[model samples]
Target: MSSEAKPLSGLRVLIPRGGPWGDLVSRALRERGAHTVTAPLVDFAHTSEEDQLVDALKRLEAGEFDWMTATSSTVADVLTHHNAVIPQETNVAVVGEATAVAFRDAGYHITRTPERENSTHALLEEWSEIDTGDVLKVLTLRSDVAIPVLTEGLIDRGHDVTQVLAFRTVGVPASVHIREDIESGRINALLVASAKIAEEVAAQFPQLPENTIVACVGVNTLEVAAALGLPDDADDPAHADYELKRALIESVESVIDQSDMLD
Candidate 1:
């Protein structure tokens, strides 16, 4: 498409994340003609149980599991940090686009990612199709604060599932300029990917401009945003860059209409 025909031209969007994924998203947005401001509101830290995490990585390298699940890109970073190796025989399932990209970027292969939902439950639902019926050994790495839903679901599916706490999610304070931008409607849209991100957005930008579009990455995140009083204008479970770009386009159009009215 021509520059003028691009969906997100002249739009400024806020991404509440940093690092590889944030950089990737920013690049994608720029390609579609949007200006991106990345102010990470969350950062991952090592889990307190260092010994347990180390032991799990050693076991993972030793090929003790037939399948391993990585729910987020942050978990993939933790794996890279610990030098965790997955044997060739073990299949790795990544939950979302971010995790798949992160794994591939980290020089690991992904066996599967839920084609539709980008969630753990979707992975479990596709288990029979992805694996043989016989009981299999699996290792799941996730944030410390993550619910044990995936582990419990794997157990229910007759797999030997070992759950390991990989890291902890902590809030990162937004800079004063980021805070001021939200209040002044300088950002046309905010992309919220997780409950924690929603909480951070809520905590950091207590009052969002009415014209600011809030888009959630999935239905669950949408619900969480709603509960936190930050109801979203759009949602995409897969958190695709294209979807986020489309949402921003709609917000940009709305902004244009409001400006026309004011004129």
Candidate 2:
């Protein structure tokens, strides 16, 4: 749709996810004339929690592990950001090609690349017999946003796991602002990422403006937004900033299209 046809012009949107992902999504929404609001819910920082990672590397250098699963490129960045290097002998498993390329850039040799969606569930489908292999420990390098889902699943299969908090989601001051904005009974749309942020919004706002459409990145996030009483009025999206922003516009258009006032 043309920028002038943007129905969300002068509309307000609440964003609660933190980090570059949030920033990118917000920018896209603003480009469509929506007044994007930020309530930085997740905070990311470079952490030195890779101490054991270094030790793991030491073992790898001494020839220890059979394979390591890199969740994403960020996982490699987390390791190298702390100046840690991988053991040349440790085989690499990655969820995506981007992550595999990252491992290659980091001087690692990838033995397995997950073809399924870049999710642990997809990875597990391919390696269901993970514990049966000589795979020592499946080192899952991840941000705090990673719940115990993967860890719990992997361990259930009898595989040894190492937990490292490569990064964490920090709640910022945006929750308070979003509450005030939404409860003020003015605004047109709400954009969200994780269920955690949506939960905080509900707890703080208690009430949101009627006719305010809620848009989110994934189906799971929408499920959480539903639990927070957002209902089924939002547009479906895959969490990418540009794609979600477009979905948000289309949703608003769909709403307006059915309204007599717009006609």
lDDT values of the candidates? Answer: 0.72, 0.57
What are the RMSD figures for all models against the true structure?
A: 8.2, 9.0
Please give each candidate's TM-score. Answer: 0.80, 0.60
Show model 1 residue runs off by greater than 4 Å: 114-122, 129-131, 147-149, 231-246, 249-263
Positional deviation of 170 in candidate 1, in angstroms? 0.9
Indicate which candidate wins on lDDT: 1
What lDDT tens digits, residue by residue, belong to model 2 across residues 188-261?
56765566666766665556665555665455566777777764433445432434446574543331111100
What's the TM for model 1? 0.80
Task: Tell me how far the alpha carbon of residue 175 in candidate 1 is from the true structure, in angstroms, after superposition.
Answer: 1.1
**Candidate 2 clashes between residue pairs 3 or more apart in a chain or in different chains:** 39-174, 43-170
> Could you give me the TM-score of model 2 versus the true structure?
0.60
Tens-digit per-residue lDDT, 1-263, candidate 1: 87667777766888777765676667777777788899888888988878888998898899898888876678778888978788888888876556777888898988876654555666678866435678888888888656666678877767887887788889999888888887898887787767788889898888888667676664456577889988454344554444654556443332111111010
